[model samples]
Target: MATLLHIDSSVFPHGASASRPVTDAFRRTWEEQHPQGTVIYRDLATDPVPHLTADAHLAGFSDPATHTPEQAAAFAARVALIEELEGADAVLIGAPMYNYSIPSTLKAWLDNVILAGRTFMAEDSKIKGTPVTIVASRGGSYAPGTPREDYEYVQTYLRAVLADTLGLDVDFIVPELTMAPQNPAMTELVPLYEASRERALEDATTKAKELTERLAA
Candidate 1:
């Protein structure tokens, strides 16, 4: 059975934030669909990724074949992160939009995962592809063409990093924006928030099922 690596970085639980609920919903559905498949969950909020140091940066940019001991060690850590991604058939990222972008912890995790010549490569000046799914939660609405659309840097940047930098085919499910000031205020927003969470969870499960079938095929 296929293995799924789930990552969640939300600071809040199901009520205050959508990330946890969305991820939980997806995992539940995925488990039902692929009973034999295994799920590995990593919570960045609880156990965060180590920040990239200058030495780590230098090591990543250096030639692996000619790396010094320190550089090699750093490279090894990065390789380990990439290996996690490589070992999994699919990945689910549960992230809440913070300041119009992903949390620093999530970004650090991405930095560790997207290593040159490992997760991706420059083949004939073009990048190949892998597959990833992101379940994003935001406090306010920011769809394209909307006034707050420009605040959607989180999704935009994530798409670019996963696709262009890491060569991953990234899919996303954004629990429609909640907590916006509306006519009905809390009464209307609460239901909308709950509905979005349910939708996100369902979407994740469906995607996992489809992915597992494809892998099996």
Candidate 2:
């Protein structure tokens, strides 16, 4: 059976989080297609992983025999995370924008798994070419020609890391203008937000089904 690594970094729950429901939609569709498949899930907001430390950073380059007690503990935690990514057939992430960037918890996870000679540039990397779907929900529109297009860092940074560095086959489903319904200043954009939400859910379902079929093939 196929395995999926799902990571959710939304500070809010499914009912309130713009990104959570969309990612949940994708996961539901994926599970429906692969009833017997495995899903290794991580809810970063509730159970955040430790941030990458100096010990952990240096341990990746040093010999195991030379590791200090601090390095051993820190690096061990990172290894578990890396192993999860490597073992997955596909990955799904809920990375809602926080202050024009990804959440710190998600960034911490990335720092742990993105080792130089392991997940990044290794000749025998397990995660290389693995398919990854990212749900990048934001409070405002940042598409090309948008007023805040230049402030969009989530997709741009992730594409560079996930595709350029790790060599994953990356795809994104974005739901924009999420704050329109909640923020009075953006009340006029509510319709656009609703439409974006609908499109994102549809995209998530479609992408999940397509990925399952491709994996089975």
Candidate 3:
């Protein structure tokens, strides 16, 4: 059976997090298609991984046999996280924008998982061609021509690391204006917010089924 790595980094609880529900939708759809498939879940909000420390950064490059106990422990964490990513055929990420960027917890996860010569190398990437679906939720509008279009960093940053570095096959599902309902300043865009949410779910459902079929094939 296919294996999926489902990761959620939203600080908010499930009911309050916009990205969580969208990722949940994709997960539900995927599970329906492959009831026996494996799902590896990591909730970064509650169980955040430590950011890459100086030792951890150096440990990634040093030979395993030469690692001291301190360096070994740091490198061990990266190995475990990398193993999870390497074992999965597909990945689902919930990346809610915090101040026009991804959560620090998510960034920490990335730093650990994207190791040189392990997740990637000079000529080829170890996780190359692995499909990754990112549900990017933003509070305010940041689409083309929007006032803060250039400020959108979540997708840009992920693409650079996941696709450019790790060589993952990446696609994004953006659910914009998530704060419209709660922000008085964005009250006028509530309808658009609803529409964006609906579209996000629809896109997730379709892409999920497609990915499942691909895996089965």
lDDT (10s digit) by residue, model 1, range 148-180: 987788789998888767777788989865554
Q: Model 2 RMSD to the real structure?
A: 0.6
Taken over the whole model, the C-alpha lDDT of each candidate is: 0.77, 0.97, 0.93
lDDT of the structure predicted as candidate 3: 0.93
- Residue range 1-217, candidate 3, lDDT tens digits: 8889999999999899999989999999999988998999999999999999988999988888998898999989988999999899899999999988999999999999988887887465557899999999999878889999999999999999999889999999999999999999889999999999999999999999999888778
By TM-score, who's the top model here? 2
- List residue ranges in candidate 2 displaced over 4 A: none
Which pairs of residues have clashing backbones in candidate 2? none
Number of backbone-clashing residue pairs for each candidate, in the order shown: 0, 0, 0
* Predicted structure 1, TM vs. truth: 0.85
Which regions in candidate 1 have their CA more than 4 angstroms from the true location? 63-69, 122-128, 180-188
Ranking by TM-score: 2, 3, 1
> How many clashes (backbone atoms < 3 Å, residues ≥3 apart in a chain or on different chains) does model 2 have?
0
Q: List the residue pairs that clash in candidate 3.
A: none
Q: Against the hidden reference, what TM-scores do the models get?
A: 0.85, 0.99, 0.97
TM-score between candidate 3 and the true structure: 0.97
As for TM-score, the candidate ahead, 2 or 3, is 2
